[model samples]
Target: FSYCAKDLGLVLLAEIDEAEIFKPIAQLKNQIIVISIIISSIFVGIAFYVSRTISRPITKLRNAVDRISKGDYNYKVDIKSSDEIGHLGHQFDEMRKSVLETNRNLNMLVKERTKELTDMTNALDATAIVMVTNRDGRITKINQKFIEISKFTEKELIGKNPCIVKSGYHRTEFFEKMWKTISHGEIFEGEIKNKAKDGTYYWVKTTIVPFLDENRQPKQYIAIQNDITDLKNIEYALQEALKRDKESAEIIKRHVEELKRTNIELRRKDKLKDEFLSMTSHELKTPLTPIIGWCGALKTPRILGDLAPQQRAAVETIESNAVKLEKMISDMLDAQKLDLNEMKFTIGEVQVDLLFNKIKKDFEPLLKEKDIQFIIRAETADIRLESDEARILQVISALLYNSIDFVPKTGGRIEVTAESRDNNIIFCIKDNGPGIPKDKQEFLFKKFYQVDTSLTRKHGGTGLGLAISKGIVTRLGGTIWVETEEGKGSNFYFSLPRKY
Candidate 1:
């Protein structure tokens, strides 16, 4: 019984020890299960918290970002946590605020720019002349200037055809060309004359531009015009005046030509008169020459007896009258020949010394009668010059006669000088007579033009000697001129070219 009881006690003790070990192990397992359950619950709570905090805010941010991508700048995220997830939410919230602010500023800038553009457009519309038209060739919009000029109000012009103010001044061709140009979307500029509402004509320089639509078709035409009626009127008046002035000038020219014809006829009549006088003088001289020759024969000792003093005086008078009559005939003939250009010249070389000697001898008698001294000074004794000898002699004779007539009987003198200058022989005849007047010098060599007509009558000349001399000198390829001052002596010069 003791052994059995001891065995039962050992078994009990082993069972109790096993129970203790199993209980502790089971308690450890239970504690482990409880701890795992608490940890899993905590993890689930953390996951829920993270999901609510991070995932929810992130999702909200993603939605806001999506909205922003679709141009919705008004989206926002609500993330107000304080952990790491909260921090992420805070960052997303800050990003949303920054994006929203940027969007707000951008919108404000766009609004400002849009407002500015709107103001500019409104200002341009108000200040500039704007006209719009529909595609139907009708007046739609007109500016203030157009309304003022057209004598039509905006209400009167709108919806009205442009032909309402056409004025009917332009022809159909004008409108045809205008239509053709504008229909092709071209711009045309021209001046147009139109009748105003008051029935008065006016002008406008106009420019028409065609507006095109998207299909490249002409949609409307805009015409801008300014008034130029006054300028047109002024130009028209000027053109008319110019036409009248041109007509008057033509008439005056015709009258002047008629007067010139009449003057030419008068000159012909004068020439006929000169020719008649010359013929008459010659006719009278033919008979007088014979009479004078018979008188000379009567004075000869072999033919006439001694005469008394009174007879001698009468014969002398007849002789003197005959000489005067012969001089008048010669002067008339010379004047006629000079006027008709019928006088001929015999050109030849004449020694200067011989010419001077002949002139001195010929004038010696006249010089002695006037009690005046005549001088000849030659630079070269053998100087020979080409000239019409007889004509030159006649010129010299006439000059001597003029000097004798003009010079004072007591103190005046005449000088003849010849010299070689510039391949020509120059001869000068100077006299201490009263010089010609300034106004008369230009006409000194003109036909029938004399310094003193009374002097011409008293001195007995045809008033053509100097003119003939000038013609002769010009024909000989030489020149003749005179230099004189009032109250100073006159020097007459002539030059003849030297032979090579």
Candidate 2:
């Protein structure tokens, strides 16, 4: 029984030992589960903390990059970490600053360029020149002055060739030369006559320059010009005026030479005229002396008593011819004296009626011989005037004699009338004779001008009667002229100042 009890106790002790060992294993397992739960919780907390720190800043940085890409430089990433993310933030800020600064400078540069272009345009406008042409010689740009000068707008000139402004004044070769010069990257300066849009012509001093491209080829052209129409016109007018002045000067010089030649010829003719007058006077007087002497001697009874009828007729003819010759001599002397300006006048008050009666009686015998009817009409009786008595009588006698000589033999009549008008006494002699021709009237009072050259020979008298009468009347402060129409009679009138 002791051995059996001892076996039980050993078995119980082994079971207890096993239970104890199993209990410790169970506790160890429980402890292991708790430790795993704690470690998992700690690891989860650390993961959440790391994810929040990294993800939040990374998300902010991502948003900043998005804003920057969209040209928004104002956005910045806030990363407080002391790692690469902070360095990246700094770099991002710096990049944003640089981009902003670059943008600002670009905007400023654009503004400055815009202002410079505006200033250049304004300067071109003031200068009245601005033009741009394309590669094909078409106009592309035109300024305000170009519009004003051409009478065209920018739209009109654009796409139009420069030939559209041609005035046709220049040859085609001229434009060809200009094109050749400008197309070779050369500048051309010349005057061009161009037509405006209104079809009027204008002169322009032009400078054409070629616009070159990167390859040095002519891509476009610019033409600057100024209107010189008025200046050119003034120069042309001056040249024309100078040419006319030169022509006029040549003509005047020729006329001056001609006048000098004419004066020389006139001087020689004047000398010849004086010599002819002296010779004519001497020849006329030489015949008058002997005839007058014989007529006076034959009138004496002691030389010849009771002449026969035929002899008496001869003596009367001789006496009458001698008297006519004596009168002609007196007229020639008077003409010479008047021509030399040596004729003297006796100014005094004269009885005009008495003078007229004496002249009428003196011409009565000649009128009787010619069978001419004479009538005297007076406006007033004894109208005295201030004049030379003998000179006045001489003028009246000469005029009466001319009237009798020209009076037609078939129907001859003379009428003498006197009147006082204004401050003058006018005496008129009207004769029924062949009237003077229109063209012959101006020379009627000229010395040696005979209306009827045949009448001078038939009447046996010099043609100096009316000439001497004109001179005497002129000296007496009077004027004489004839009024007549063709186929009508002549009226010779004289006016003497009454108060002279």
Candidate 3:
């Protein structure tokens, strides 16, 4: 606010008390409060009137609109006030009733007209194999076509399992997967081989679709099958005839091919020989362990306490050879199981530091004997992972053994390191050894393969250690590979997902 004073020219202005000018309003404070309260009450009354006359009826009509959109013509607004909105509500209810009546008659007409088409489809069911099996795999219904194909009477099939027609052609896992898929309301389509009542197998291109209930769970399975036995037989006959025609043309070249084929057969036989040796080693070690154990007991200080120097030495020799045999037998079994994918994993969380410490102790004697430098670097304190601990140990030990065999005898260096890689742990074993050549690296993981096959090869092995290591690593959801040049050190790296 600006103020102007009409004093003597530029003379000092006087102070003024403005409270007196507003004294009337201050004295009428109660009256002002009363007027404010009356204004608020009036506004409240109008808002209440608008809500009942406008918002309420509109809300009911909006709900009715929603019901109509969802195909529920039976919904109506029940507003009964004597106002324009109430009149509109009554008119809306009349329209809804009219539409509901019309819709009911229309739906009845549709079903009646389509009944003939549905019957025609039912009549055609006799031409195709239609069988219904409940979720439990029990036959619930089988049409004439199904009975004709299976050679079973409707009475015999009504409550029996669908496995009555199984030909034993597929594995148990196949059926397990089929049930798992259909039980989740998915369709399973495949070429199925079935056995007839006469013990003859037939082929059918089959599709089983699940019928789902309101909860989306399969209530039953509808199996529609098309007989493909004749087609399959024709395909087999054509393949055989083509094979014969090719064989006739290759008669002159057969001798050269025979030589190559013979080499393959020889290699196959060599594989069998290794497997036999592995089996034989297992048998030999079973008895040898008991023999070695008894010999040791005889020379012990407490059990059979007394022994001559030569006797004690002989007993030690037996024990030493027994340990070697045991190691060989274990390697054989591991190789066999790994090659056939027969190894099972008992997965659990493994503390990396504890595992590495145990491995260090196991290899301490070997390191001292060879005068080799063994280093273990576990980078993190809380490093743990989910895996088969025994298999993981086996793979690491195999890598260490390979290093021990090939690394320089005087100044060999082997380093085992583990560190976290994002959500996984990377394990690496590096060795300063006679490095492998590029040509030999590719075949290093093949069963019974070796870089050197000569009798006097410096590094002695059955040539299955790395292959078994690779197999174990792969099965544990990890990849193993050796990085080496012709003269540099080799680094074997594998990674396992870390659970913690």
Q: Where does candidate 2 stray beyond 4 Å? A: 1-262, 265-269, 279-283, 308-315, 454-461
What is each predicted model's overall lDDT from 0 to 1? 0.79, 0.85, 0.86
Error of 2 at 37 (Å): 99
For model 3, the superposed segments whose C-alpha errors exceed 4 Å read: 1-247, 250-281, 303-313
- Give the range where candidate 2 is weakest over 10 consecutive residues by summed lDDT: 7-16
Report the C-alpha lDDT of model 1 over 38-151, residue by residue, as the tens digit. 999999999998788778877876786688789775665566767776576567668777888998999999999999999985774565444566777888888786665667
Question: For each candidate, what TM-score against the reference?
Answer: 0.51, 0.48, 0.45
- Candidate 1 vs candidate 3: the lDDT winner is 3
Q: What is the lDDT of candidate 3?
A: 0.86
Ranking by lDDT: 3, 2, 1
Minimal lDDT window, size 10, model 1: 7-16
Clashing pairs in 1: none
Who wins the TM-score comparison?
1
The digit string of per-residue lDDT tens for model 3 on 1-500 reads: 33555674444556656787668778698788999999999999999998988998889888888988898886667887778888888998998988889899998998987997888658758556888988788999988888888899999999899999999999999889988889888999998899999888899988999999999998889998888999999999989987888877587478779989999999999889867876797788789878878977888789877888998998889888777777767777888877667788899989899899899999989898989999997988778899888889999998899889889978899999999989888999999998999989999888889888888977767777888888988888888888998789899988887751
Residue 206, candidate 1: C-alpha displacement in angstroms: 16
